[model samples]
Target: MKNSIAILLCVSIFFIQCKEADSNSKKPTVYTVGDSTVKNGQGDGAAGLWGWGDFINQFLDTTKVKVKNHALGGTSSRTYIQKGLWKPVLDSLKKGDYVLLQFGHNDDGPINDDFRARGTIKGIGSESEEIDNMLTGKHEVVHTYGWYLSKIIKEAKSKGAIPVVMSPIPRNKWEGKKVPRNNDSYGLWAKQVAAREHVTFIDLNEQMAQKMETLGEDKIYGNLFYKKDHTHTSAKGAVLAASIITQELKKTNNSLKDFVLENPTIILPKKTNIYLIGDSTVANNGIPEAVGWGVELHKYLDTTRVNIINKARGGRSSRTFYNEKLWQAVYDTLQKGDFVLMQFGHNDGGHIDQPKYRGSIQGISDSTMVVTKNDSIKETVHTYGWYMATFINQAKEKGAIPIVFSHIPRNEWKGNSVERADKTYGLWAKQIAQKNNAAFIDLNDSISVAYEKIGAKKIKQFFPKDHTHTNADGASFNASIVVICLKADKSLGLRDLVLSQKEIDRLSQIALNTSIENKK
Candidate 1:
């Protein structure tokens, strides 16, 4: 009876060990490899740039499997393997692990150049060429792009791991109505390799291109690419690309699809505030008949998403606005994700240090002027550009986006065309925005364009009593024009927060009718 009991205990222990081992083996991981678009610097999304590999985990089921992004920037199919970057990744793969491969952006460089030397022979042919390594000073044989990709697939499969081949994401190059794709080159070869190897394939290039077509060139260029670079993606673009990959993975028959999250919560951003600041042209004149563009701007905005705060005061220049503690109040209430629209220059053209000391020096120079206030207190004033720059830099420090607008044009016309301030304050405001990396709107030029289109005689109705101040109807018209400008500006990200085109048209017509009524 004792011998039988001991045997039964040993059998129970053996079965429990087997079950634990089996459970451990079932826990798989998905590994990613490719170029900069797959993974950029440190993969932390620094400097407004990002890569899809860093963001894919958000849509994955981490409880089921882990995700590891092993991609390196500036690496191609040839160099990635040649430089021993793929060896560690391959060594880490287990029986149930999955690998995702993407390349091609850096594969088109010179084959033996010292700077990069990342190029691979075109096509999936078995052809290879001997070349002297410019960086390592060793003789090496470079294979075709297809050969490099095939090697990865074969090695993964040999290790009992599933391989998913993906075509490189498309660049921000557009051809007419659509973004051009790479279906003829790397994309075609990648798909062929997957089919030849009997592995799952994803057309990431085609998918991203289709998405780009839907987003249009404006959103793609403004929101996706890093600055003027068409290759790398910004944080927003990277998230979008990762989301696309998640969707494609769900369509596959592989076991990895079971690890994708279903109905993941999409986080919406908090509401933003839009603050307007400038001179009389942007202020709320107390009289109902006399108004400013700032007062009427809220009518064209989506109040649910953004609150328009017109903080502009009449007869206040950039210097006075900063010195009088008006800017301090606005700055105190400013918060992250807020927007400041600054338009000054109408009241910044007065003489300095002579009783009415309101004017500031021109240009972006660091020049200063001494002035006496009403209380006989002496103060030093900086250039007009300096004050504007101060406002821009302060807003940026407070995590708010500052947009500079040129002062509206006076009721002055040279022949059939309305004169513009593009040479003076308009030009200076644009310079300040560029220097400070802020968004700029040429309100002076935009209003002038409308006036020129309407002709000098008919456009005079916009100015009721003075050339600098507009009547209520004219304020609404200018405000609608500002809305049009915001819609056209891709970098502002304010298109969705504005009223519909139909509403804008209706408001414009109403303003025109009011103008006629006021004239009568």
Candidate 2:
């Protein structure tokens, strides 16, 4: 009898271990259902657009739970069910699985229209509308948006699956410094349905709107949406939206929340300082009519993320800038990751040994000259390339990134084309950047492109009285040009730190208008 009991106990232990293994191997799935903002274009990021559902999986522990996104573009809560999209998802539901439902973007359209009938009645009441389908030519009974959402919740619960109802994300439209929310409409109805069914409710619209308010209107247009598209999101925007959803999930403390990864804190490096070293075109002299591009550059930058210090002074060439102790002041403050933009050529045309000598020998050669100035101060001047190389090497030694910029164009037009310095300073700057392993921006060429596009008639408005130093409008335009170049160069890593395209355009237009008015 003792031997038989021992065998039975061993068999029982083996069975318990097998059961535990099977339980551990089984993986739960979290399904999502919503409109375009949740999952746009099959969640493939087509046309440079993305949806939040495509990114939410990154925040979850996929090893423990799987994510399935069934959101379709141009879908509403009513059509999602009417087109039988919910049936397959419902059939796949199992006990311990989770279903997240978000809708209401297309629920406000006309119910029975000949052109894409996809709307449902509003509210969560027991209301139904009988209509003859124009496209299908069949008599159908339509329910309210709330009724459809409640159906999804109840069906999920009936199948022993957990239901999570999220109000739709708010549109990009803003009203009086705030992004308008769906609180009175779909948001309220979603909350009511979740309460009635005892399911988890997430006020995504309000939460996202609050975040948008914090980001402000300029950032909302710049950082969130694609070009001229306020409905859909860019890749960065999708990530931000998904992060908000992740936070709400944790707050809800649902069973599925256990499968989510803890939100990782992003530790950014100390703010880098940007120093502008150039001629009068890059200085700040408190002259409204003679504003420099460097003075206006800070407007396009996210100041909270970086600092801009315009150390440029008038009448300073690449040679004179270092000789006059200006470069030393900037170099003294250089920290790791700091940036320096150097542009000089306007005053570098004088004779090397004259009293007003400022020009450095052109090209990347190591040519040097001894100049005796009016103050009888003997100085050893190096070639333009040598000076640039010195600055680049010194900055790199201090763990700073050095960038070279060609001189800005002087509003000179040749047969409807803006003349650029591509043959002179531009070429030398590019050569120096390549030789020293530094970044280079051809500001002359870049601004010339904009000028050609704007035509000489409109472009001349930026240059108020002179061809060299620009007015406020012209300075802002040049600053925007520099920003555009910085954004294109991935090595600079400034694209993610600049303002949005919309914000830039808005500011540029304002500057243009203001300058034109002042000139008139």
| Model 2 agreement with the true structure over 1-520: per-residue lDDT tens digits | 9999999999999999998778655778789998998899977665446788888888888868889998899989978888899999999988988998899889999999887788889899998999999966879899998889988988988988998988888888878898988899999999999999888998988998898899888877546764357788866677777888888888886987797788654322245588899888999868866788998997787664568989999888888888888888888889988888888888886678886688888777988778788899888888888888888898888898899998899889999888877777788888998998999998888889888987887777877668888887799989988998898898886776677778888888888777668667
| 468 Cα displacement, candidate 1 (Å) | 6.8
Query: Which candidate's lDDT is highest?
Result: 1
TM-score list, all predictions? 0.57, 0.60
Off by over 4 Å in 1: 1-27, 44-47, 225-227, 266-520
lDDT of 1 by residue, 259-338 (tens): 78887654322456999999888898797655889988877775534679989998889999998889999999999889
The residue-level lDDT of candidate 1 at 355 comes to 56
For model 1, which pairs clash?
Answer: none
In model 2, the worst 10-residue window by lDDT is 263-272
CA lDDT of each candidate?
0.85, 0.84
